[model samples]
Target: MEMSRALDISAAGMDAQSMRLRVIAENLANQDTTGSAPGADPYRRKTITFAETMDRGTGQPEVQVKQIGQDMSDFTTRYEPSHPAADAQGYVKLPNVNNFVELMDMREAERSYSANLNVMQVTRSMLTRTIDLLR
Candidate 1:
């Protein structure tokens, strides 16, 4: 029962990290995205939040994505007179997503996902051995 609970917890963690990775990827992809119209806002960076909840059946804490929210930080502006999205002052609004930050976040999420996967693999191996011994 304990082993099953551990597996469940690890799986939940992996799921949460998977969603986080996806968000990071999206942010990276839109790092340079700008608004299509003048004075319009560009794409905003997405953020994921995780929350711990008790599993009713297993009575164990499991991680889940609480919400996916947008970054409220101010967008950077650049002078580009020829750009269609340029405002009256020839300033183009760029996305708030930072490449460096997105890369770092991707690395962290990858590490977390790997850790959860390792836990699941180890738990499965232990369960397999237990069954073999019983047989």
Candidate 2:
């Protein structure tokens, strides 16, 4: 029963990290995305927040996605007079998504996901060995 709870917690952690990875990917993909019209705002970077909650059935704290929200940071501007989204001052607003930051976040999320997967695998192995001992 404890092994089952471990599996559940690991699964929840994996799920949360997967969502984080997805959000990071989206930010990376839209790093160069600009608005179609002049003076329009570009795509804002999205951020994922996680929270731990007790699973009533298992009485274990599991990770969950608390929010997927936009980054409030200011967008970078580039001098591109010919661009369609250029403002009156010949400056184009770029998305707030930073490739370096996104990559770092992605790496962290991947590592977390891998760790959770390892935990699940170990738990499964233990359960298997316990069953073998009974047989």
Candidate 3:
């Protein structure tokens, strides 16, 4: 019973980290995405927040996605007169997503996910061994 609870908690953590990874991937994929029209804003970076909630059945704290929100940081501007998104001043607004930051976030998310997976595997193995001992 405790092992099952552990498995459930780890699964929840893995799910949250997976969502974080997805958000990071989207940010990376849209790093170069600029606005389609002049003076239009480019893609804004997305951020994932996690919260712990009590699972009613298990009475355990489980990680959950709190929100997928936009980053309010100012977008970088590039001087590109010929670009379609260029403004009157020949400056184009770029997405706020930074590749380096996204990569770092991705690495952290991957580690969290891996750790949760490891926990789940260990819990499952222990449960299996316990069942075997009884038989």
lDDT of 2 by residue, 31-110 (tens): 99999999899999999999989999988999999999999999999999999999999999999998889988989999
Off by over 4 Å in 2: none
Q: Candidate 3: lDDT of 28?
A: 89
After superposition, candidate 3 runs with Cα above 4 Å error: none
Per-residue lDDT of model 1, residues 40-103, tens digit only: 9999999999999999988899999999999999999999989999999999999999888988
Candidate 3 colliding pairs = none
**lDDT for predicted candidate 1 compared with the true structure:** 0.93
User: After best superposition, candidate 3 residue 90: deviation in angstroms?
Assistant: 0.6
What are the per-model C-alpha RMSD values against the true structure? 0.8, 0.7, 0.7
**Candidate 1, superposed: residue stretches over 4 Å from native:** none
Structure candidate 2, residue pairs in collision = none
| Tens digit of per-residue lDDT, candidate 3, span 14-108 | 99999999899899899999999999999999999999899999999999999999999999999999999999999999999988899899899
